[model samples]
Target: MAAAPPPPSCCLVALPPHAKDGLVVFGKNSARPRDEVQEVVYFPAADHEPESKVECTYISVDQVPKTHAIVISRPAWLWGAEMGANDQG
Candidate 1:
């Protein structure tokens, strides 16, 4: 069976501009599908490296920019993210 589509909303909670300390604490907890496994992958920032190919879930783009480093957890068979942490944080 195919997966269901996402709900029609941005996932953030909407709050009035004047609301202060209304929702300072937030967290997430989710379970991976039983058929899938995930692993951690890191992409280092290389501003002056030769142009190369990047393989994504559906297609291969000929040139992709890697100006900022990132660490991501992803499925072993796919070339995308399950969760990611950027270089800054």
Candidate 2:
């Protein structure tokens, strides 16, 4: 079988520290249509189930000041996330 194609290319920017009005903002643009992009929240945690084989590469609960809410942009057709920010910031 042929391999699945990669998702659309995207550009992301985290606003500078000196952003106007002192607001911290993140922006992203992707070649995918707006209809296929979505906003979601993930409560990240380790998969401790013995039978499960998935591993999380991002933050683990024990490795931070504390875990916080994760707000993210997700692609409708893929399990991978596009971009996100935590409540910590």
Candidate 3:
């Protein structure tokens, strides 16, 4: 028998008048191979206290004196964001 088709990856955005708030929606289907590994991570807010540093990479830079919280979904062995969203206001 022939193999079945894969599911579709989709995203939806609802927009109204500029005076009103809108909504955003995302849905990922069977886009990646089943053997691959992905992880969803949550980063809490720093509140701009002693400042945040960039130690997650191979380079060094200035500290972030101000920042917000965020969540990212990326590869299991890499520090990259394939999909991410912020929880800030």
Candidate 4:
């Protein structure tokens, strides 16, 4: 028998100062025509006040023959971090 293929890598998105309160994660599956997965995670403020930086990690268990991508968006108050697979994968 053949060994099972390794799981696909995970996708991560970082949020800059401001929009740290709300974080939404979007994922796409191979069979689905559109995004079939949606997740939301809330991170507490660092010191009672609103957080300025936030980072999130998303992993896909539903393996597909096609590539997997993650989309992240937030309010104008927040910004995105400049990271790559090397940061976490």
TM-score winner among the candidates? Answer: 3
lDDT of 1 at 82: 62
What is the lDDT, from 0 to 100, of the residue 25 in candidate 3? 48
- Taking all chains together, the TM-score of candidate 2 against the true structure is 0.45
Model 4 misplaced regions, further than 4 Å: 1-33, 47-89
Q: Candidate 1 versus the native: TM-score? A: 0.52
Candidate 3: tens digits of C-alpha lDDT, residues 1-89: 99978545555444555335564445555366678898889988765546455755466565677656788887787665777778753
lDDT of all predictions: 0.66, 0.60, 0.66, 0.34
Which should have the higher TM-score, number 2 or number 3?
3
Lowest lDDT 10-residue stretch of candidate 3: 10-19
Ordered by lDDT, highest first, the candidates read 3, 1, 2, 4
Per-candidate RMSD, Å: 7.0, 9.5, 5.8, 17.3
lDDT of 1 by residue, 1-89 (tens): 99988654223333555347654332233355657877878899876446677678899777655567998877788787767778886
Q: How do the predictions measure up, each by TM-score?
A: 0.52, 0.45, 0.56, 0.16
Show where candidate 3 strays beyond 4 Å. Answer: 1-23, 29-33, 47-52
1 against 4, candidate with superior TM-score:
1
Query: What overall lDDT, based on C-alpha atoms, would model 4 receive against the true structure?
Result: 0.34
Tens-digit per-residue lDDT, 1-89, candidate 2:
99989657756555656577767665666676757757576766433443434334543333443345676777665555777777676
